[model samples]
Target: MGRGGVPRPTGRGVGVLAAGVLVVLVGWLLQAPALVFAGTTLVVLIVAVTISLLFRTADVRVTRRFTPDRGVAGWSAVETVAVLPRGGRTSGTVRVREQLPFGRLSDAEAAAVLLVPGRASSAVFRHHDLPRGRHRIGPLHVDLVESYGVARRRVVASGVAEFVVVPEVVEVGLGRESRALGDGSRRQREHSLAGGEDDPVTREYRRGDPMRRVHWKATARHGELMVRQEEQHGLPSARVVIAVAAEGWPDARPTLPPTSRVGVRAATAAIPLVSDAFEWAVSFAATVAVEVGHAGSATVLTTPGGTLVARHDPDSTTMFLDDLADLRLDDAPGAPAPAPSPREPVVAVVSGLGRPDLDLLVASRAPGSSAVAVVVTAALPLGAGLTSRPTRPADGRARADDRVLAPDEVAGALRDSGWRVVETDSSVDVGRLITTSGVLDD
Candidate 1:
């Protein structure tokens, strides 16, 4: 655990000791003085080496650095480790091996050789396709070997460090209306051009108002001096709701892969055992939130439990991504649905919609607001044929025993309630849909 631990003999040292004992015994039995002298010399040498290494003090420090500081899932990251001598120089070659967390690095790749430790030695390696969530790395294991290679001492050079991998954000092309979707400048221009006397973007003229800034039509309508607001731009707001309840993703629930170290880390990090459909929903939601934030919209991200990211600013997108990396699923059913943001656009990414979920979507529709729902069809519950038997004849009528609605039925219900519903499976590319399907277009 510390630098002061005693040195132990290597296999070579053990062999030499055994040979020396055997030689001494043979010399005694045969009455040979030369053999006895050689055997004694070997024993003394082994003891001397062991004693030297046991008391030897070396000040070695280990430090690790990550290239970008922040790691993203599905991206490559470089880990650099440096071993520097503090005051004293190493007497012989030192074998340095980093104690990486369970799947961070292979045994061969985690080790490095410091030939002559009179100067600092460093090792740099790249890890590809970093998994999402948190990981622990390090506690450098330094093995000090003497010139004879008969004895070695192991010491802990560094403590463990934490590495966090945030969720990946895909760039989604919002098509021709991308600029108009969340751009404050475009919204301001359109509002100013089509606004009436009661336009919220205009105000009564104050003292020292420029004549060019005066709104003549508004002034005549109000019978008072009216002026256009200076640089007034209303940035659009959006709400992204992601369903996390286990009950919402019944059909798509899959057992975590037994051999996945990332899955284990995710569970230890408090991330839930999510279904494939839920993962797709989360990724889609994350991508949309980041893209919307890039477009200068204040986006709020919520789950069935509560709000995750309250406000999306320039830096909040990263915060939201990190939060998504640790997002967990709720076990209880009937968790309260997030309240609608009156007139703001709302996008709900969900799977297996029930009647309550459908009702919430319908109630979220306001006079001027747009509601969009991305339903993961792969996770939706099956019709009566799978879950229950129909009590009535096969006349395409509603069956009394039908408890869960099918994917198409859920989409139809939401569409009837004034929602723009997009039905997709987990394998579909959301970015492709945004570009070719015009899912975000007005």
Candidate 2:
């Protein structure tokens, strides 16, 4: 269990010992000196080998490195383990086994056998279909076997190491109007000419300021020269809200398509126990956030739990993906949703729309704000089995009878409240939907 090795006899060693005992017993009955000597020699050899192996230690250092450091879900990552012996003398044949999380990798890929290790031996393997989450890799188990395979010693070679698997971000295209909204030129001119006193896009006038550039309204209110700061209006601001509560998603367990690399075991660990609809929602939300960020917009990501990512910088985007990696249904069941930023574009990703969800979307529609709701129409594709009963709230707040609103009803309600709504199912490609649906257009 610790650094010290535990030596034990192999199956061949046990068989030899049993045979030696039987030979000795027969020799005693026959009163033969040569037979007794041979039996005694065999017994002595087995005992000596065991004792030698018990005293000998395989002093080696084992370290593991991951390619790209962080993996992406549904992708492949390479793991390389290097074993270096400390002393000049060669060690016995070594067998290295790395313990992976969730049994995602096969034994043959995770295990390696090396010949006598005089210098160093390294094993490199690729793990496919990486699950999203923080997973621990090691505390390597090393086995040292003698040349004859009579005795073996087992020891823990390395301590545990952890790596993160972030959610996948896909390319999403915005409509022409949506792209124009993100452009800084028109917004810069609007803010420069009509910015109020508290506007961040305007700043105190600097030396040699052009009179035409001065914001007279802000100047009059502040009793000082104020000029429009065109640089501050470079990037637009946007918000993305995703419904994470279990009650908002349907209750159905659908089998993954045959081509999916994620099996049941990996899925159970990587994804929350919620339905496929919820998983699709998370992926789509992540894709929207990244796409908005790429469009020169500072996007904030929020869940019912609260604000998960406040900024759309590279670091914040990474943090947002990390948060989505292990997002669970019961994480923030009854928590209040964060209010959307006023006058900013908002995108809400939801499934099995409920009363609370509708209220949140309706309230997010500010006078100048644009709100879009992407609703998953079906929990999963047709032919994928689904349960007839509704999903009860995991927090036990809602009864089974309080089923979610139908997708058409939810879309109609939002449209009445002056919001654009996009209806999709789990089977549709999120990127394609965003590109062709024209939901982001003005």
Best by TM-score: 2
Taking the tens digit of each residue's C-alpha lDDT, what string does model 2 give over 1-442?
3374667778998898889988998899999988888898988998888778766666677778999798987789988888887765646567777767645344344465563556668878677877667877876777767678887777776567888887777766562236624653355456547643345457898653445456777788899988766643344667777776665566533333222467779866555454567767777777877766555555666663453533453225766677677676656454443455457777887765566656765776556887888878554555643232354665867566666676667778888888788878877887788777754554
Query: Which candidate achieves the best lDDT against the true structure?
Result: 2
Candidate 2: regions farther than 4 A off: 1-53, 87-90, 104-107, 110-120, 173-177, 184-235, 250-276, 304-310, 314-316, 333-338, 377-418
Could you give the C-alpha RMSD of every candidate to the true structure, in order shown? Answer: 10.3, 8.5
The CA lDDT at 109 in model 2 is: 49
lDDT of 2 at 98: 70
Q: lDDT (CA) for every model shown?
A: 0.65, 0.67
Candidate 1 collision pairs: none
Error of 1 at 43 (Å): 9.0
**How do the predictions measure up, each by TM-score?**
0.64, 0.70
